[model samples]
Target: MGFRQRTMENLVITPAFWQDRRVLVTGHTGFKGGWLALWLQTMGARVIGLALPPATQPNLFELTGLAGQMVSILADIRDRDALAAALASHRPEVVFHLAAQALVLPSYSRPAETYATNVMGTVNLLDAIRQTGCVRSVVIVSSDKCYQPRATACTESDPLGATDPYSSSKACTELVAAAYRSSFFASGDHRGHATALATARAGNAIGGGDWSTGRLVPDAVRAFADRRPLLVRHPEAVRPWQHVLEPLAGYLILGERLYQQGARFAEAWNFGPGGETAHSVADLLTKMAGMWGGGATWRRDDETHPHEAQSLRLDATKAARALPWHPRWPLATALQMTVDWYRAHLDGQDMVAVSRQQIARYCECEPKAVAP
Candidate 1:
């Protein structure tokens, strides 16, 4: 299909664009990557996954049996040669770079590893892309924490700064992508490569199968399942929380636009939830506890934890106007879906079917105006 035709179709994720496409997703063993890989696979794309083994037991990647469905490569993104070799072998036309040490508390303890994995690992991947010249569209997944702390919602043009190692590394990651886009992949480059690269900054993603420690939803699930009181850290902290599929949908749309129109869509984007979806951690836990009926309880943690932002929001107006993407599932629906998935998992049901059903349902959903 032509660029005009795609734009007329509103650049929504269509199977026609992804069918039989050669795609590579780094960090496919992780939570967001696992979902993206699965969605692409369902659209008939040939997906190549590169990352270390699953970080936690009962992770989404392994539980959904994603490894068997795609080309799963167990390798560290920190290894430059390994990344280059994998890119050369896969020769993918689309690349999604998601491999990183993706947590805040862990970054406080292991700052060096966080920088090495998030900062240098990105350097390795972009440099490897420079060597293997087949890639067309590249979307680097960054965090909303990459923005400088502020009282209002952040836009793509906001000043990028962070005090925490994880957030700082992501800020540097965005710089790395911008440098590569300007130096090597410039639209006027004479190298004959048309790789359109961009960065995606999203808000807090709460969904099923994120078994990572230090995150709110997963920690709640583990605590509630064990019949223990969940510990709440920074309960008053407010975030623009949305389902994992919200930002993933934005990434897919951005990738497609980058491939078809190149420089026109090659820029940073914010795929955050609507303003009404912003809620405090305590509020989220209350709703979750209500959904998890049998004696689910939580209490405030008094531990002196490391500093985290009390408020983080993103202005996704650029995405809403440009890519024409809007969040489909409201916070209530997102929470219900998340709780349903875990409840099914706890019952030992086939999670693969459950996960796919959610994806199908999400695809059919229309955007609704969320009430504040």
Candidate 2:
């Protein structure tokens, strides 16, 4: 069916929609998950997080004081029994699955673990939701790398492909979700399965409180803070860089629409920056250095690395056209927000407050819908 661009004055994420809602967020200890959890809390949603312990020492889950704020269950998504138990216990109506082995470089060394986690982990989560039977909406977050690499931006209907273990695992994940939705949670037969599932394919998400190794923004933040030169591996690689909140907003919007609108919004969707906003890694870093002006510097890594894509972008036209969704910040503004967040954390400021402030600021901006 032909889609028309959706536009509205203010985004309709009403408190009435999320208030007192129970949300289950897998991988809540990671960067994006933590931010999403915090945002849900701001909307008065009861959040239950299930994932392995924080991947890093200074992870966002700990820094934002999420443990004290919500019910946190530390367990691996690969453990099917444990995941099922967590879901049965929480009985959440909304499930946002963000748990995965998210790095391309790490996946090369641990291909088995990557697939076990990203692929089976998804299978486990969906099965658990089916077994428990309380979930109404599930937004499975997958990366844009799940798409076959093309010179042009990828749409939701693009043929699935992957170059590395991480990317391939995400592709497998997308397939898994599709199979599950078709076989079990088919929207037409919601009597027994009664779950609506959608996969969110988003671009490279950049923000602070992310200390994952091999990621550009967090590595730059740490190096800049330590007064050391940041290393650039694939400096020429282009990505659709968006703020952390951008896709999270899309995910929430998708989740809400799925709950309210059902089968109409239950499918794969892309939430990514479009056009000139998608920049190269080198250009992104140069702009980030300017935002973080302690004379922060970066040098090209002479060492050889695993095969990574040189050009990747996401076409979020489906989301922009079918729903009230669009990127809220320019790349520069997102970089500045990243720097500002890291600086605030360094000064020993209350990160919970800072994160809330940023989310509020993002929500205040008017969404500019894209043309179909």
Candidate 3:
């Protein structure tokens, strides 16, 4: 039997699996990383985060009160010495690297910084692993844009390419990771050196506490909060959208499986929602406006923007067949959960509590237990 067929019972991420487990999350200050860090903490894991401070003022890291939950190391991923020192000092068993210059428009202006952060930063981390010898499972989070242009859904084995600086940088990250896996962390009998490395590619991750400019969900939230009509750019651009937790869950499962089973699980994996889940930018914004409710409206912006892919989707068949993974929430449900989170924040609800509540609700395997 394949890996997915071998274990079907304990598909859920159980607290029993995470109790006292040591995890290191790079980019913990970013939107998806913050959510993953908080979720890991709730599962009773010993979590440590390595990244610069939150990029925006109202970042998820601060709003979710994640500082009290994990050890936060403020450092740049491009700094090889600092990154190596953090890894050596923390000595976590599993490492999740999500640090990168992740904005497309910004990359158009700051291409050098984007390449430095996304490409060479990956190189620095893998090199550190060569010296640290304590990590067993490493999940290097890349983007769906790493894949070559495709009319149908892109798969794990698809050719890697890039039409822009941001996408090309991610594509470079993938190549660097593959080279490291083959050269240093090769699956051999070398006991301490055999680290299993895999890359995770996911489409647009949307949820609350995303204060970044130039993102669809955050822009919609800001328009709602400011009581203005949202401006839609690239309205016809299609993307596969999933909740932040969807891919985060996939990462957690992939990490656990890599730690347990080794090289078989060490490869590129796509954690995107199925192709059917993809919708146009206008459709997504319209849905977001509906969820926000009061006087919510949007108009297409005629101003020309930076070059972004016109359409993209993913085929998560390999992940589904190999890792016992599948997206749990449908598009509407994901959108609803996202809208509910921002709404609660606007209503003066404690956002930390709200984030945890959503995590618990998603992992229905366990009732809301007393968080550690």
Candidates 1 and 3, the one with greater lDDT: 1
183-225 in candidate 1: lDDT tens per residue? Answer: 9886643235688999999899988899999999999999999
Residue pairs with backbone overlap in model 1 = none
Where does model 2 exceed 4 Å of error? 1-9, 189-193, 369-372
Clashing pairs in 2: none
Please report, in order, the local distance difference test score of every candidate based on alpha carbons: 0.89, 0.87, 0.85
Residue 38, model 1, lDDT: 88
RMSD in Å for model 3: 5.4
Task: Find the number of clashing residue pairs for candidate 3.
Answer: 0
Tens digit of lDDT per residue, candidate 2, span 1-372? 101101122466665678789999999999999999988887778999998899898888988888988999999999999999988888999999999899998899999999999999999999998888899899999999999998888888989988899999999999999999889886865444478999999999999789999888888888988889998988888999899999999999999988877788889999988844679999998988887888999989999888999988888898987866888888888998899998998898998889877887787787764422
Model 1: lDDT equals 0.89
TM-score of each prediction: 0.95, 0.95, 0.94
Q: Which stretches of candidate 3 lie over 4 Å from their true place?
A: 1-10, 189-193, 365-372
Worst ten in a row by lDDT for model 2: 1-10
